[model samples]
Target: MALSTNRSPQDTLKIAQVRSANVDGTWAIANKAGIAYSHDPVLGVSVVSKSDWGRLAEELSSSEFKMVKIDSVAASYGALQVWSVQTPRFDNARAQRRHSGLGAIWAVYSDEKSSVPDIQDFTEPVDAVYTWVDSSDPDWQTSYSQFKNSVPAAGSHPTSRDIARYTSRDELKYSLRSLEMNMPWIRQIYLVTAGQTPKWLDTSNTKIKVIDHAEIFESPEDCLPTFNSHAIETQISRISGLSEHFIYVNDDIFFGRPMSPNVFFTGSGSVKYSLAKAHYAEASNPRLAVNLAAKLNAELIEAKYGKTTARKFKHVAHPQRRSIHKLINKAFSAEVQETAKHKFRHVNDVSVPSALAHYVAAAEGVGVPADIDYAYVDLGGNHLPMNLYRLVRGRGMQMFCLNEVASVSENEKRGQLAKRVLDDLFPYKSSFEK
Candidate 1:
């Protein structure tokens, strides 16, 4: 049979290896055809001779395997075409390159060694940090109600206290599943919460650590019962044992396909920040909490560097550095402290990891702009059903976010629809789950 198109790039490579091994064992192509090659998990195979490459291609096609030419290169020795062998399940599947580097399917060579230059892969350890809260928990709700009631209604943004923002439709469970399936290279995961853990999560997983709010906050007494995500995100760098390079993820964001560490970090360990086309500086609603935070961040950037921050960042996993965050804390000490002390989302707060840190890192020359195939699905929007359908059927995005802007009257209906889509997207249980 042919390789399934739905399989991930890593799984496709494994299947290719198995098929190659079978051809070597049964046909004895290496001995009869006189070919020398080496193979690895990253780069599939390297063929040294052109005649042997022709023979191998013939054997693979004759054995009922499908092959498509993905990329080609011309060298002084000869012309080479990279072949990816997989059954195309969709009309446009042939156009898609499964991996970032050379074909995971197979590649022919004209020289003694691989002519393709390495893609600057790094070996540094990377971690993931997620800020989550279980709003349904009695103790958490008690604190949330107490603090939420204390805030005055006159000056707060309309959607700042929206309950839809805190409602968890078990997105974290599937998000972790997506991470485990696609980004297996992550070294560790720190789940920051308000003294509540999901019942389905397996705390025994060594790769995951459940962090409490009191543990990371500089002043636990001041920030302990806070429901503000901005306040909590300000303390993410304070997570004990966090890696030098880490990705800050919100529970609503999910990895859609196989991803490499290079997607988030460069070979030299510089962070790659995904920028959106929307400019926060030109935003119409400055009264919105998120917009106000972006405007505040732009002010800081402009005051320090004299250059205006225009574009906003995508709503995906934010790649960050601990040292850079420390630098930001030192540079904007008062702003950082002010954000941390706010019990609720205030107009004066700055989005630290998502917005401010990216700008500061860019100014210091440690961060570079990158592009990702990202999708943002707003749950409160009218096209929720269509968006979810497209997200699942396409399966081409690198990352996606299911964001709820405000608490609608039909919260239960929308929650059910979103959960159904998530379950369809990821039905298999991850190791982090019991």
Candidate 2:
């Protein structure tokens, strides 16, 4: 990864918007932050009917509107629910189903990727999709079928879908190949997984490196597996590949719509913010670990209580505000917190790798008060305990750019009610084509 020499402070004054229809709460948070957010009603409609999503797929395949998939939204759809009761008009109400004026604003502007006529042109309202890049074939539907045959036994694994749903080799290969060929905005690619590898990877160009359970840590739990698989491993592997400070992307992320890398890069001490997702409250740790050596400005220093002259110092002088705890948390782990404090407080100049090492040391039962600095951070939804702890500790506050997209269940038909509502937000590109 190439580091960006154009490190300028991000412009906080600019009016940035994100498309996050499935995550109404995230949109509400963005609105509170004064950022405009839109969500694809089409996705909502599709969740309510598959035919709608099929229509969207048809339009995208035709390149009608320079479509892009709002993948993060799709990834989070399982946790969201459309209330049966009519949603009341309230500022705090979720963007997905509310019926007030602001809700109307969201409804009018949000749209499926293929319906926005100027989506291909960034000069218009900004639009984008996330993708997991790799070098493989463009069509993996065949692999999707093969994956069904290879699923493990049901007793060992508990999933909503049969094991066959995940064993799609063709789909994985096709998706990875698209990443290799289409996404030019990327500077580096990191593949994080504890699952099976896609067969396409065997023959494709190695632009992206894969980091599975074996490569990242000794065990999944030790690695805090509940956190985003890509977030931890990619952050570690791609730190060295920081070509102009690259962006972290998920496997499903794809830019079917038009937008530029400039959308994410703003010359601010690299933009950092939690991505849009479901949120919940958890116990917060005030004494969480921040950069120490960067905090102390010295290479070596004796611990406040220990006899050691000086521990090994690491990294440059800069305070990072993020924490590993933000990634995972255990409700009643005060001992863990004490241990983290001992390590982070006393350690000198901790780099990301060194920090991981420290965590390893603490995990191995070599610390006190049970790591006080190991407080829980938010992980959106999913494994609440895991997200409550591990965090993506970083140098400063993060900036965000969202695409108001919707997430649909795998079994749900796409683009019926959600698409109709989305059409109300943005006219179909066919209007312009006509």
Candidate 3:
């Protein structure tokens, strides 16, 4: 059978299993060898044996499949060694496993007789929060225009108020689809909006809740009709019944593949945040609101801990702690209030969850810098076609973001392409959708 080049990692693993079952009968070989094995979602089947692995390895290596060794680090858990079974073409998608006594215990083993928790496993309830706006709504557009005219044109970032920033291509729908497909462990999803809900969204779904700005902000009268994302983000932690641990995601960000809780949090409930190589201190466009917020965040960190923060966090799903947000809100009451007061993106605004919260959490020794398999595609970039092609062909990324930084006319043209790409990536509708 010829597999499509754009197959997901799970698809690759399934293909490997079918070939193995056909070439080497599953029970005949394993039962004769007297080896115990279990099924792993990511690594296919994991066989644990007290005897030497030489015979099993040789028996599995055939013309259809090849066995390769993998060395992986389990962050705080130490080193992990596993042998992977892969096809020649789909080498990136492999079924792998190590001995029973290997470094860290796999999830497949954690369920069995071993009741001890793995150092990498995080069992706490983690929710997902998304801040979204629909610029096409007549009421929203009227409010946006009113706020845009109210603010002075000088000193404000060009793209801060750009319609591209608020444009919706049904990206939120696909993002939720990706979440349900890839990260099923999420306990609940809160869609924070400006009193507008997606028409296609299934509000009756118990897993999802729609939260208006009035519900989260302390002073809804002053902050309502706000077009500023920074302002909205500052009060996300105020959501009623929000979990202690949560991930803040933008409407354009997506989960590309299956992920474990360990990717965001440690066994001890500490956050693992991904940092980008880009730093605000070296920003080419310091006037941009995002970079300016980073610079302001650096200053705040410097003032609080005597340590300077220069690097920016990645545009992926940010792991956030409600307690940390409350801490920042109290510690920097003036700054946080100032941010909330902005009716639109202003020069004085500071990003809370995206940038500031990570730095503050790190300074308090609860957030650790980490790495992720991520990709960022600029919707307005010249190489958009190539970037999206690579994204689809290599369906191995953990997370990705499709950001539009173009003008209204430019975004209108690019929006179609983005929708097509999203539709191709996520064809199935999630329960959150109608």
Candidate 4:
């Protein structure tokens, strides 16, 4: 049946079932309410029991109200590991840190693997897990292998070992194992892959829902964009099933520690913004790069029909280098000279979603944020300046975990992981609750 374009007026909704749970009774309720159902198979999870899964499949097949919202948390959780070139530490400290912030968390993966870490000991209770499996084609293997063996080409900062370590299926296995161990805490697991759902995940007590990836994300858009939109839409769609808020996470970074949900939801702003840091700059000529980046990025601005376009931007350009001190002085003056009114709000206040919308809209000649009003935080994890720059340009936090007190790897030479409590604490904004 087609999804309802109109929104439901009801504010409160019931979770009929999420995975391998007693489906018969719940469907009885769903049937009475004339609601839809959903599940994810690839990640080995279901919201209903085996009998209920069968019943749901048949009922959904014949019923017009089979529309249900599926959470792809597991898929996303795994995908993080599958896609990234890094290994995450699985410990209690990191797990608690993540749990307390966002009420829900999911794993994402780009491919399959044999072994994974055991995370039941680290993480808090979960609302759901999401798993994503790419296509069955052989080429995915080739790409995965290449990514596993390859290091960042020259000029890249993350180092060869970091990249190589996370490229293999074994690494993914370890991560998955960790995630699987956390299953009991998860309310449901969404598998975004094709083919049959794994059998071991099904049970008479849990509920399992399996549907094609296309069902969650309709085509006409590419994968990344589709994932972004579906990520939001899928949650919004689950008005009757999920809580008001959920979480999105990358998989390569494991739950090496314990976490509390209170930290993330503690603040009471109309909106909460967070992002990973991409890059940093300490130039003597602040106006030069900012102005240049802005100008180059300005192609995104739209000129209203028959409206006049002004030469609104200006900055200094030099051919020869003076002393660093002289450069700093000139740059500082230029930056001050440029009025706040002339610059884009994104330069001062921004977040990941807004940043993406800005540039994406910019590509289409739409207006960018010249003035923004919102709370923002940085989420930093990258090995290169360009990656960091792109992440910043994309609206991610520039220094998210920089001050984290308890991290997965403390070598300083190794990658960063989510922070934990008691282990260490990063200096959070005052707005964040203690």
Top TM-score prediction, candidate number: 1
Tell me which of candidates 1 and 4 scores higher on lDDT: 1
Candidate number that wins on TM-score, 1 or 4 = 1
Q: TM-score, each model?
A: 0.78, 0.28, 0.78, 0.28
lDDT by residue (187-254, candidate 4, tens digit) is 44343333334333332334324444445432213322121211322222222343223333222323
All candidates in order of lDDT, best leading: 1, 3, 4, 2
Summing lDDT over every window of 10 consecutive residues in candidate 4, give the lowest-scoring window: 313-322
Cα lDDT tens digits, model 1, 183-285, are: 6668899999988889988899899999999999999887677878999999999999999999999999987655667778877878899998887767777
For each candidate in turn, give its C-alpha RMSD to the true structure in angstroms.
6.1, 20.1, 6.7, 21.4
Q: Which portions of model 2 miss their true places by more than 4 Å? A: 1-182, 202-204, 218-244, 272-434
Question: Which is the better candidate, 2 or 3, if ranked by lDDT?
Answer: 3
Where does model 3 exceed 4 Å of error? 1-116, 152-155, 411-413
For model 1 the TM-score comes to 0.78
Root-mean-square deviation of candidate 1? 6.1
| Candidate-wise lDDT, in order | 0.72, 0.26, 0.71, 0.27
Residue 23 lDDT in candidate 1: 32
- TM-score of model 3 vs. true structure: 0.78
The clash count of every prediction, one per candidate, is: 0, 93, 0, 98
